[model samples]
Target: MEIIARRIATEFPKTNQAVGVNIVSLVNALAGQVRIGLLIFLGVVTIVLLIACTNVANLMLARYAARQKEMALRTALGAGRLRLMQQLLAESTLVALAGGAIGLLLASWGTQVLVALLAKNFQIPRIENTHADGWVLGFTLALSLATGIIFGVVPALAAASPDLNQSLREASRTAIAGPGGWRLRNTLVVAETALALVLLAGAGLLLKGLLVMRTTAPGFGTENVLTVDFSLPRRLATLPGTPSMNTAIVMTDRVRFFDALLDRARSVPGVRSAALVADLPLGGGQDSLGFQILGRQPPPPR
Candidate 1:
C-alpha cells in the first residue's frame, strides 16, 4: 500500500504538495468501520453460549435426579461405576452432537445470507462468497465435544456414585431434587442470569450507538434527493484502440457534458436540482494527493 501510494503521488504534476506513504492491513482496512459492533456481537454471543451450556448442565442434573432410582437399581444389579458414568456421558454427548449437526446446517445457509446482506449494505468488494468450510466444521465439532464434556461431567459424576442405600431408601419417598442438587442448579441459574443481563446491557449500548449515528447530521441534505452516475464515451475516456485524450481535453469535455446533462435534467418537470461531484461523501474515499504549506515545514503523515 505504501508503495502504491508513492506511485500515485508520482503521477501528480504539481510539486508544491507534500506526500507521505503508509500501509494498512487488509483485514483491518475492511473491518475497521464495524469493528466495535462486531466485537459487541462476539461478546454477546460468547455470553449466550456460556448461558446455554449452564442451562444444559442444569437440565442434565435434573435428568440425573429423575433417574436416581434407575441408577441405584443398576448399581444393585452389579453395574460398574465407570460403566454407569460412561453411559450418562455418552447420552449427553449424543445430544450435543445432534445439536451441532443441526447448527452446521444452519450455518451453511446463514453464511451465504449474511454475505448477501452485507454486500447490499456496504460497498465491500468481496462480501458475497463466504461459506461454512473446513475450519468452520472443525470449530463446530470441537465446540460440541467441549460443551458435552462441560455440561455432562457433574451429572455423570452424580449418577456414577449414587448412594445405593440412600438413593434406594429415598427413591420412593419423593420425586423432588435433593438440597445439594438444588443448590448447584441455583448457582448455575444465577450465573446464567447475570451473564445474560451483561449481554443485554451490551446490546442496549450498541443499539444506542447506532441510534446516535443515525440521528447525527451527515453534513448533507438527503431529503427528496436524486442521484445519477455519469461516464464518458470510449473515445473521450481514451480506450486502447483510440488516441489518448489529454487531461485538459478530457476535463473540458466532461464539464461540457455535465453542463448539457444538467440543463436537460433541470428541464424535466418537478425536478428540484442537479449537481455533480468527483466523489461522494461517506463513500469509500477521495483520491489523495500530497500538499505542503507554501511557507512552513512539512506536516507529518496522518
Candidate 2:
C-alpha cells in the first residue's frame, strides 16, 4: 500500500494537493461506505466464537468431572496420561468439526438473505456472487481443528491427572475438581459472560442510535419526491461508416435530451414541478468545482 501511495504521489503531483492511494481487499472495496460497519460486525462474530469455545470448554470440564473414576481406573490399569489427553482432544475435535459443518450450511443461507436485504440500500458490487467455496471450506476445517485443540486442552489436562485415591473410593460418585480446575472453569465462565455483555452493550448502542436517527428530521419533506439518475454517453450515436459528431454538437444534443425529458415529465398529470440537479440532496457523494476569486490570491491548502 505504501509503495502504491508513493507511486501515485510521484506520478500525479498537484500544487497544494496531496495525491495518495489506498489499497483494500476486493471485499472491502465492494463494501464501500459500509466497510467500517462490516468490520465491526466481523469483530462481534469473533467475540461470539470465543464465547462459544469457552462454553464448550466448560462443558468438557464438567464431562471430565463426571467420568473421573473411569479415567482413574484406566490410569491405574495401564493408560498413559498422554494417551488420555489425545483421546479427549480427538473427541473434542470431532465435536467441533460437526458444529462447523452445521454452521457452514447456515452461513450459506444467511449470506443470500443478507445480500437480498441490503442490495437495494447499498451499492455492493457483485454481492450476489458471494458463496461458500473451497477456500471457505478450508477455513472452516482449519478453524474447527484449532478451536477444538485450544478449548480441549485444559479439560484434557485436568482429566488426565485425577486423584486416584479419591476417585477410587466407593462413596465418591463424582471426583472433586481441585482449585486449579475450579479456577479454570470459573475463568472461562467469567470470560464468556464478559464477552456476552460486551456484545449486548454494543447492540444496545446500535439500536439506540437507530432509534434516534429514526426520530430525527432531515429539514425537508421527502414525500412525493422521485429522483432519477443517468449518465450521458461520451460519443454520440452515428451510422456505420459515418464520422461521429464533435464535442459541441454532442453537448447540444445532451442538453436537448434533458429538456425534452423534463418537458415530458411535466406534461404528466399530478406533476407539480420538475427540476435538474447535478447531485441529489443527502446523496452519499458530493460534486465540487474549484474556482478562484478575481484579483485575489487563492488561500493555501490546509
Candidate 3:
C-alpha cells in the first residue's frame, strides 16, 4: 500500500508541473506588453508637442510683424537694439511659461482619463501607480523654453533692426510699394505650409499602416471565446525539493481551476466541444524547443 501511494504522489506532481510554468510566463508577457504600450504613447505625445511648437512659433512671427513699427520707434529713440531684443525674448518666455502651466493642469487630468481608458481595454496590473512624474514636468519646461527661443530670436532681431524703419514706412504706403515686407510674409507662410504638409503626409502613412494591421486576418475562430490567466507569487515559486514540488502545487491548482471553468462553460446550452491548450494561439511570444529531426543530421565537419 505504501508503494502504491508513493507512485500516485510521483505521478500527480509530474502532471501539475507544466501548468505552473504557463501561468508565470503569461503574467510576465502581459507586464512587458504594458511597458511597450506606455513607451509608444509617450513617443506619440512628443511628436504632437513638436507640431504645436511650430504653430506657436508662426503666431509669434506674425505678432512681430504687426509690432515692427513700434519696435522701429523704440530703436529710433534711446532704446538700444539689444535691449529691445531682450525685452521681446522676455515676453516670449512669459507666454511659453503661461502655456506650460496650463498644459500641466491639462496633462494631470488627461493622465487619469488615459489610465482609465487603458484599463477598460487591457488587464493591466496596478495601473493607479501610473502618473506624470518629475521627469515629465522637467521635460515639458525644457521643451517650452527651447521652443520659445527657437521662434523668438529671428523675429525679435528683425523687429529691432535699423533697416526695419524703411520696411515699416514702405508697409504703410500703397500695397504696390510694400514688396519687401510682402515677400518676407509670403516666405514665412510658405515655410509653415511646407512643414505642415510634411507632417500631414507622415500622419497619413501611419494611419494607413494601422488600418492595414487592423484588417489583417487573425487566423483563428474567436467567436464566443474568452481567455483567463493565472500566476503564482514570486516567493512561493521556488522551493527546495527534487523535481520542484512547489511548481507542482501551483500548476495543479491552475489546471484544475481552468478545467472546472471550461466544464461549466461547456454545460451551457448550444456550447460545442472544449479543448485544453497549454498556450494561446497567435499570442505575443514565441514558443521554441530544441529538437532533432528524423533521419536528418547536422552538417559534417563544418
Cα lDDT for residue 115, model 2?
84
- Assess candidate 2 and give its TM-score to the true structure: 0.73
Which candidate leads in TM-score?
1
In the range 1-302, model 2's lDDT, one tens digit per residue, is: 67777776666566323755557888666666677877898999999999999999999998888888999999999999999999999999999999999999999899889888877666677776778889999999999999999999888999999888888884454474678778888998999999999999999999999999888898898889888776665454442344555666776787798899899989999999998888666775567668999999999763
lDDT of 2 at 181: 74
* Candidates sorted on lDDT, descending: 2, 1, 3
Error of 3 at 286 (Å): 4.0
Q: Model 1: residues >4 Å from true position, as ranges?
A: 1-22, 34-36, 172-176, 226-269, 287-302
Per-candidate TM vs. native? Answer: 0.75, 0.73, 0.66
What is the clash count of model 3?
0
Which candidate would rank higher by lDDT, 1 or 2? 2
lDDT of all predictions: 0.79, 0.84, 0.69
| Candidate 2 clashing pairs, residues 3+ apart or interchain | none
Q: Write the per-residue lDDT of candidate 3 for residues 1-302, one digit (tens) a residue.
A: 55555665567755433332223466566587777767766666665666676567656666776676677677677789889989988888888878998998899999899899977776688786789899889987987788787767766665566465474475552222245545655666676677667667767988999999888888877778866564545644455354746666767766677678789978978777666665787664477655778899955321
Lowest-sum lDDT 10-residue window in model 2: 233-242
> Ten-residue segment with the worst summed lDDT in candidate 1?
171-180
Number of backbone-clashing residue pairs for each candidate, in the order shown: 1, 0, 0
Local lDDT at 44 for model 3? 64
